[model samples]
Target: MNLETFLLKDKIQEIENGFKIKNGWLLICESTYDEIESKGIYCALIKNKYLEKYSSSHSWPINYGYEGKSNVYGDNSYQTYDNEEVEPFLFRKSFNIKDGIKKYIDVGEEFILFYRLFEEVADKQNRVYYFVNDYGELDEVIVVEPNKVKIKLKYLKEYITMRDMHFFISFEYMILRKTIDKDWNLEFIDKDFSNENYFYNHLIRNDMGTYQSWILGNYFIKPNVSKRSYLDFDNFHCEEFIIGIDENGEIILKNPKYESKGNFTFTYFKKEVLNKYYNNPIEYEIDSFSVSNKYFRLKIDNNLENIIPVLLTDLLILPENEQLHWKQYNIPITEDLKLSSTYYKTMILGNWYESPESIDLYFKHLYNDFNKKWYQKFGWNLYKPLAKEDEFNFKALHLITENNIKSFCEQTLTIVKLTIDRINEKEIVKGIELEPNTKGISKFQKFLESKNMDIPDLFEFLRHLQSLRSGLIAHTFSNSNKECKKALEYFNFNERNLIDIQKEIFKKSIRTFSTLETHLL
Candidate 1:
């Protein structure tokens, strides 16, 4: 039989039996150019009728001549077809129809059948075509072909699923495969499927509820398709059914999430997709980065040296309020020394002028005061001394006497003086040497000359005050009434004033040091 005869008979029989084809039907047959050409002729037969109906409904003049006299028609008769030609309706040229069939045939026989069924309903009331496989379930609707079939099928599937129906259908146009299965469903997979493992392991596995929560609350996916997934999860449903398995033993679905294992993890900083991306410890660049919380706990592998700098950089960027919580206690001061030695070394470097006994006393006072006043305020313990009581033996104290404090203070002061002279060359007031005329005295005299202020005499007086205080602290060994009163009086009378003056001096010193460091760098 001819193609037309076959289609007409089949459709006639279906309509006669009180069975109208639904909008979604699959045609699962191999077709050839000859078959498509035969179907094209059949498609043409009724194309004109749809065109006529469309034009008439839209009040467009028919392309063909009208029959009967003009006076026989009323004034409204021409108006009835006024806009028919302007309406957007399907109009296939003979060549385009032929070409479309040929293209369908190139996709192989099954696609040709789909094309044929698609054209048959192109102008018909019914928009569905069904393909039945005897080996599969009966009443099975394989694929639905329409211009908007994808969206339509999605809505249909959702409506059906909501009604608790077991069967659902989907179409694969690229491969021209039609599937009807009880278990098959739709799901959104990450675009970079290759690195899906990383996302799944790090993000999804820990909290599938997060995905559910996000979808339910935001009605959208987090790290949207345009960003991480590349697949829109909005209005997309997860298929509970596992269609089949691939050679690698992975489940494949009829409408599976299209993901490339290589494109799973997305790195914002790197601006690249990672296939085998992992959350393992690796160097990463961070700009203006900081954690919201105060205390940050880090887990490091056996090797820690490489990660410490990165961690420190992150801590430095934290706000002052936030930074106060980072208590750097129990940190190893040196790799090669005993803890006691490390503690003693830190104490000497941090507060050099204080004797070991004085260091212990100051730390105790500071710690108690901090715990009482600032611990809650700052959320950090700043007065953490390195040495424990057990490490502070009588022998250790004897070994580190007042001489150590005095020597360290003198050496540090000398270095500070040299640094000041080196930086303040332009500020020298010219030629005012002390009586000694030694290198140290000359340098001191030159420093006083450099400053364009009467503050030199004040500085000289403050130096004397510092020298006397140092003498009392070094020689007395005890904060006796005499030494204490002298020390207190000097600090109260001169030390406070000197400290205020030193603020501007320190500012200049810092600027000079920074400039020097920049040049060195």
Candidate 2:
């Protein structure tokens, strides 16, 4: 919502003279005041009845203007204020009594007018302009073309004060800084406001500022139009909000909004997807055993359902339920997000990759496959491999350490081998020891070497890694074999070698897998 202000040619001239204004609130219209005076139309204006320091006053001593729709006659001036400034004329000329008059005085161009003290003034037709309104107290607007609504500064100032915010800005690479003086005056420390690079270099480069975090969620977001034009975050020469903190002390991220044709960066779904899609599922499970909890856990508090309203408010979006904070509709926080980055990625991107425009099927398919397999086969066993089974059921339980490692080992190794096999499909080798002629490197390693990739130990490592299953068998046998004594005497058996081999194999498998994934997978 914007405040309204009144103005006329005579009033503007008076303000331009020695008369002062408060908070610099006044509109300057292109049309002559005489035309409006003839109309006897009405309008309101904000005046500089009292010009106090830092209040930014403007004088509007209009001989003819409207305080309302009705006309007023005077050699005297009038004043008023509105966020939408600039427009002209007096009583009869102020506005039309009928629809015709309305069409005549269509405010063609207006400016939230202001003037600099002690500056030279040119003739009216060719005079320079500076938006000296309440919003631009610190700015020196040398050329405020009709195209720009400079009053936005007032709205911005209001926002800052009302919200009690802290900020840094760099609009489209233009350095813009705002600071408060000891007298509570908001001013700029612009070393050279004329030079864009000076601000960029000083604030962005030297001052360590960034706009990557700016997004729609943090601000009083609205459709980019009129008063909302400031929402066009990516508009060139536009101010970029580098950082901000809300009333709740949450970190406000900067997300520069770029222009798009008939589309928006953020979208809302009418309902949650209670129905799961079966076409290509993203199978993701929480990695409770993960070394880094951040990768798996949701950073938000566990009271997710309860906090959605707060999030929506912070995001400046309409909340689903304002009274949700009160105990009315009970929505449980069912799934704990402390599992993996998979959920966040998929959930965030799902909207963009949805139907209608199909550009990234290949990548999307891979993503779905990875997540599906992760949830379906990997994360289930991550924290408690073998389903909490003790050293008893070797045949049934997954006797491995981590959930995904075993499958990862198998999958990565297969990819590595398949890649190598693709390059050497027709070759046959006769070997007695792992390699026919080389130093214990397998065909896979040789293939990578030929391709000028780093060689990895494959056969040798797999030879040891393959012992895990056997080690499990031995452990089972050693634990409860009915003929253990007889079997030991006959085979001269000791489970130590198999046990040792299994441990080495596990280590080697991890190392080999990493190398293969790096070189080939």
Candidate 3:
């Protein structure tokens, strides 16, 4: 049979309706809802195929390739092919329903077909589809094909027994079932009653014996005219009675409050029905009540409004009491100066100064010690021979003194020459150019003249002293160690003091350079 021919919209609708009414039979299984919805039109087509076959009482189990099995059709053993031919098809076959109900009654393959149909239907509808057992109980079935027929049936029965089944079947399910079983009774129960109590008292009370309560709960009460008795049935209710007609021709109670005319009739049902109707049936405003345990009654009134305010007040007062308690126990105290003497003790020991801060003071003390040592080592009265007749303890001192003076003069001349070169490069001085005539002394003097700068008198004197110290140390003198020691002391004092002075002078020079650059620019 061509499965495509059965893919009609009406047939799909029929299958959908069948699933709604059939307890536990979901045309759309819960698992496949997302997948089917995502592929909407494609799902609809596949669903149509199943619904059409289902409506015609044919099997529409999705054929997944099956396992090999042999079957005897006419007393001859026919070996079933152990390939795709024997494998259950993933798509349903037209003869699946009849074959499933008949030959495959206990076969593991039937369960696979059952679940496939269930899944296809459930997927298209986007709701959980279920299967029903012979006991009229609804059951949730697994999406996968069952390996054992008994297991599948057991699951179906378990799910049906566990779930709270809905009595009213969907119109689509009824339509499909009607196609197969036209003589099937289609009873429509009235759901327009305000409360189950009224229906129990007035309408379904008489029909209780005819209609069994498949599930237990509050039932509608109605008059069973055929039996001439009041019936209370779980599923059926009556329509509103007209003023002129007997119970047989009366309008079914669709909406009685809207239909009833007289004030007395309307008021009676309104008070008992409309006023009592809970918009949200799940929630209710319960009143305080007393419970009796044996001989005594315990009254419990735990309304939120009455108890919350007192709780809030108690919470607010707790922090204030804690603060007061802390204040009472924690007293403030101050220590006496005598008890904390660290600062005073450090000052008294004279070890209170940081190294960097006392460096200048330390250097001053060192300078004083060096000067004293120098005076003691070499007689301070000894001086450069003012006259040629003065006898010198060291002859080398005179030569060293002359060399030192000459070196200082040469250095000063070099500095002057560099300055002159700079001035010439900048074209700052534009008068007569100074030129040296002599080879050595005249050239040196000329270099100084070009820069128009002179060496300081103090620097010249220091240079002469350095030369004298070098000579004395180099000469074979009786007290050479003494002279050398004195020379070292003098050199150290001058070197240290000069370096410090030069650092200050360099800083000032940098500031002068900045000013000069600004002005020149």
Candidate 4:
């Protein structure tokens, strides 16, 4: 599509300022900003492909505008960031349906499409303005003069921006069917034009950006009322001036400009809709699977998938009495633990134990329910309402891998160390000030000692993790490194199975948290 296709009157005239197309309906005029003479202030007419940077194999002009100039401004502004070439064939004809009135626009790909109701109020002195209210009914606002109407229209634009667009927009296009069947009202059927687009092509096919067709729903268009008003002065010397001309060769001056110092562009033309109904449904599910052991195999799906995991978890984490209840099913304790793999992917290897998310969820429940008043005294302080940074770190604490071992360790160690430090700092929780610079595992050890607590196994586990980081990550990797070897031996894991050690350590950390919650509370 070329300029001639959409041009109702195809005449490109040379005006005093610059090039005038469609008589004077649209002008590429000379615009001067400040004292600097430049001419790049108008609605750009170019291809849609040029909208995105590095989208096409195009090379843009280097010196079209000054450094740091935005794409929305200056000559060939519509040109690609790197202009391959502004091929004549690249530009296409498009239509913008503003206020029920269809008009032409220039784009490279598909047409820009959307409906805006009440874009411009009629300027006639006797014209009645009906603004869409919260109830989808038009609210009458009478203005005797055109200028007053313009002012109210400007205020209305601001109101739309400040308030919800839904209440102001009409949704008739999406909900209403053209046939006026048993479902839709006759009034809506007459106005709905979306059905035509649903069948037709080469019309207003896409919106300016995303290129999506009009969203489905019921809506009505508000018409454009503000006509093009030009600067009457011939020697139109202003600090800055940007103008938009319609296909009818008239200048629109309703754009916002600072009283003395600022720029002027066209009033934001809006195509609005009113929607009455909306619904979003979840269409997600996981497939069924089987849990097999030496004795039996249980098929799982839906509720089974959801319920079995918790039961298995209880068998591992709950008291002996709880463990006995599941044994009635004739499932071995070891087999049930392995079946946990069906639910949580991050569960410790085949043991199907717990994930970071589950850990956080566990602590959150404990904090919210049990330690509401004394979270700082209990270990729930870290998770009662995790800080934004801590929440981010915790969310990132997923399954360990060779690629993410370093990050996983760093994030895990940070969370644990922070929790320990927070507990130590609380005066309600008894602790000692061993040294000002005490940090990490040593610091945690001192805090435990201050509380007269002895958990040598937990301390050793933390030290092993710290050593892994220090020897393998924080410093440098060496096969002969004793600290690294000790850390690996502590988990009965070797260099090849480092990920396994990380996973084991992660599970231990969760258990350590459980211990903290149990004792601290």
Please give each candidate's TM-score: 0.17, 0.18, 0.13, 0.28
- For candidate 2, lDDT tens digit of each residue in 208-254? 33211100000111111232222222342211222323322222333
Candidate 4: lDDT over CA atoms?
Answer: 0.34
Task: Give candidate 3's error at residue 313 in angstroms.
Answer: 29
lDDT tens readout by residue for model 1, 326-417: 22110212122222232243332443332112232232333344334434543443222224432222111111112244433333343233
Candidate 2's displacement at residue 379, Å, is 33
Q: Candidate 1: where are CA atoms >4 Å away?
A: 1-447, 450-453, 457-490, 493-521
Q: Candidate 2, which segments miss by more than 4 Å at Cα?
A: 1-339, 348-441, 446-460, 470-514, 517-521
**Candidate 4 all-Cα RMSD:** 27.1
> Which residue segments of model 4 deviate by more than 4 Å?
1-390, 401-437, 478-482, 495-499
Which candidate ranks first by TM-score, i.e. highest? 4
- Candidate 4's TM-score reads 0.28
* Deviation of model 1 at 266, angstroms: 22
Predict model 2's lDDT versus the native.
0.26
Output the TM-score of candidate 2: 0.18
TM-score, cand. 3 vs. native: 0.13
Candidate 4: tens digits of C-alpha lDDT, residues 15-95: 121232332322211222322111222112123243232122112212122212224445645533333322221121223
* Off by more than 4 A, model 3: 1-9, 15-23, 26-68, 71-86, 89-104, 109-521
lDDT per residue (tens digit) for residues 1-521 in model 3? 12221122343443323332222222221111221121111001112213323232222122222323445557575755333212221221123574463211122344345443233233221222345433232434433232211122233322222321111111111111112223424243422222322111111111423321111111111222232111112222222221221222221222233442322221001011111111221222212211122333322211211110011111112234332221221111111111112222333343443211112222223333433443454333111212333211111110011124343333223222222212222122234354534322234333445555344432333333333334442344344556445544544544554334323322332332333234322
Candidate 4 residue 443 Cα shift, in angstroms, is 3.7
Q: Rate the local accuracy (lDDT) of all candidates.
A: 0.26, 0.26, 0.26, 0.34
